[model samples]
Target: MAKHPSLQTSKHQRFWKNRRVFLTGHTGFKGAWLSLWLISVGAKVTGYALKAPTEPNLFELLELRKDMISIVADIRDLGRLKAEMKKAKPDIVIHMAAQPIVRRSYKNPPETYETNVMGTVNLFEAVRACKSVRVVLNITTDKVYENKEIDKAYKESESLGGYDPYSASKACSEIVTASYRHSFFNPNEYGKHKVAVASARAGNVIGGGDWASDRLVPDCVRAVLRGKKIEIRNPGATRPWQYVLDPLNGYLLLCERLYKNGAKFAGAWNIGPDLKDCKSVGWIARKFCDYWGSSKTCSIQKGKHPHEAHFLKLDNLKAKKQLGWYPKWDINEALSKVVEWTKAYESGLGVREISEKQIRDFEGFPQLNDAELY
Candidate 1:
């Protein structure tokens, strides 16, 4: 196993200090976490996205609106998007807004493509018009690759294809990003353009403050909390499970690289867990039950469901070798953290405190330095 890299507080503060960041999908699970991290590190953030998708969402749980500029709008609204980006004049842009559910795509393919594909186009168009932007990272999924269900892990060089609408839409988004990168933000003209463009494909991300439906971890959390049996739809489905901070950390590092190196780091990259962390849905649910000490427990659900890839894994060698990024928490640790966060929520403890503590812990910041950093 490759050794995990240590994140120095000075290194983070030095890079992120006074940096202007324009983040989309800031109301979602991963986006909210990134937003908080950015704010903690002294980055000036302007979050543009629709209202929280769920009633009890992290954005509200953390009370994130008061700290940063929050804009509630649609990604397809090009005019609105352009105006917001122009006003923000961000040094870095992280595009994460999308219809993120796989099963939901089957019910609404048109909406999926419209948001995932056209939304990306609109973001790049806005980026093209904005001169202050130095780096733009589009967040896609590991399912963007064509899955053969083999034992082999997918690499950055893997062929792009998708069986389901959600996956296919993300694949389209990847193509759109590449088109804009080549046609507008060309690497050869980096000196003139002064912009870096890249895409990140991450694995199945599980964390607290995620109340989204049709996901395994959230389902487990909901079930355990409600004293209901956690239903397992596809027990054998295997995926590259990763803690939320693992890839968010990778995003911060990638953005830093793209900002400094420009064209050299402008391309597709995979930010995922080690191969051993990829496990089946049933395995995750069982482990989650164990950690939560759930009395209701889990039960397999029998029904025909939409087609999903049975086995999916990502090869993180490029990120490891070039970016010095590797997964810090394994599957067990990730689940334990989820349990911790969920239990804190159940106990009515201040989530922001626990969240910030977890963030500090994840970054290896000492207790004595809290006064200095925050």
Candidate 2:
């Protein structure tokens, strides 16, 4: 496959410098990482989302609010969201705010649908009214695709389906994005609107400073720190796990391409790890346990858990072919970084510096010279 240049490649460095970016969900794990990346590359960023969802979050660890125009608000507040966004007058918009937890979604289905579905509707509506915005990349999840419970990887062309509330809500968000794209921001009418919209679906992303509940990595980290056993649910279930920075790089690349090529780059794309990186949950737990050097252990939690896909993966061939994006670090490398970040946080050793250094390191990795299709 043709590999895209490393993120923040010298070719794209100047483009991101002083780039005005309006990013939603900056307090979340992926958003915090993306915010740091943007700041590293010299982007003027504005972050809007509910205050960091967790007590100890990447946002506060990095003191990200000092770097961007941080707004503590809900995405469902359309009038307030539109007003704040209009005031920011951003050149690019990345919508990432949503009720992201699958388990939490089951307990609060109404909130999930309202935020993920209608929140998307509000974002597009806001973007449509904003003349300064050129590109909008809505971040969804790999769960948006229908799960036939097979070992096959899903492509963007696959039908959208989800059994769980979080998954189904994200599917609805995808449909909403398509409707808005073809109806209001159609590529054919680019000359009139000058706005291009795209969405990204990524697999399980594990990294540091995620104190959110019910996630494997964070649960393990918190559990280890507290000297408790990590609870493992669905250990046999497999996932396409990549470092948080891996897909964040793809998101930045998508925004860059959409900014330059317009409709040619506007659509749903999967930013997932390579086929070899797709590991079972049990394997990931073992790897993390080994790397963490912890006497702490795990036990499979037996209970009636909400339904989750047993074997889920994304066919990232389109991203590799069209955008030259590639996963820089494999699952082990990703786990190592997670260990590094967790240690930094646990030891209280410059968490922000460590996180930023990792981002810098990722951008300097050996990049593919040209695009190759597998």
Candidate 3:
């Protein structure tokens, strides 16, 4: 694996240590990374989700089940999810389980809505019933914003709208979260500890261990590894691309704030990269090839591509000023680290070691500096 530059001390590490965290969708790519990171910091984590979506997904590859109380359950199953939540009795809850893909949403709209909207509602209901739960962080997508093909970065105050099934479902999830916060956890009826909820909207995340279809980085990595040219559905599509860890840090920071301040910090927040890093799909593909030493090229698919937004970006000034959070890695460095991790995993290295190495590298934890320690 290529050497990753040292990261500065993040408040996320210090705040999360020894915390009891319930993470939904622990079997997904981003959720697996978050679970591993939480475990690395000595947090007790209980994960509730289905099996890994794909065989090579980060959930199975990293063996997160070993560190977490992995419960094979679906978010749509209210009884099962509530039972697990009640048993875990976690202090903090992060709801990331959702129908996360746009193309797949087209194939199964009902499943997408059931999982994304009603699943979120059910999770919030469970959080309300759990007396031990103090802070809840709901993860939504940047696509929740109503796009008009404009160049301006989206702010948290922007209207929630979506044209696609996946995006609309997330938007609906946000609505559900807000409704619960107002109706159930109102300051008048329920005290701060009664429940604090914050919705987090993040930009397009790219990283290693994501074997999902219809994503830029994963598609490119899979294609390059198999010596095939990547088919770019929308080559000119612009997105705010950041490393997976970038938003994960923001999520943790938000959780810390909610834990400490309770209702004072309850609201929607955007955790995205700097606006300047927003680049087109083609630009990101070329950069990936350069870093991975692959000459693979991407061609715009003539007719198979579905309708997608041409431009999307986020204004993270709210997070920077309010939460004091900023992305530590640029697009180039983020892509480099992702490629390095995948290369190492593909070389027959232990997945647990690879996962721990990333956490150690990002947190600058001295004890895990040596890979042999894992």
State which candidate has the highest lDDT. 1
Structural similarity to truth (TM-score) of each candidate: 0.95, 0.95, 0.92
lDDT measured at residue 194 in model 2 versus the true structure, 0 to 100: 86
Query: What lDDT tens digits, residue by residue, belong to model 3 across residues 279-334?
Result: 99999999999999988888887876556788899999888878877777779878
Off by over 4 Å in 2: 1-12, 368-374
Candidate 3 TM-score, C-alpha based: 0.92
**C-alpha local distance difference test of each model:** 0.90, 0.88, 0.84
Ranking by lDDT: 1, 2, 3
Any runs in candidate 3 off by more than 4 Å, and if so which? 1-13, 187-193, 365-374
Give the Cα error of residue 194 in candidate 2, in Å. 0.8
Tens-digit lDDT string for candidate 2 (107-180)? 99999999999999999888877779999999999999989999999999999999999999999999999999
Name the lDDT value of residue 152 in candidate 2: 93
lDDT of 1 by residue, 1-374 (tens): 11112222635768997899999999999999998888888788999998999979999999888778999999999999999999999999999999999999999999999999999999998998888999999999999999998987999998999999999999999999999999999999999999999999999999989999999999999988878899989999999999898899999999999998999999999998889999999999999988887656668887888899999999998998898777888899899999999999899999887788788778873322213323
RMSD of each: 6.0, 4.1, 5.7
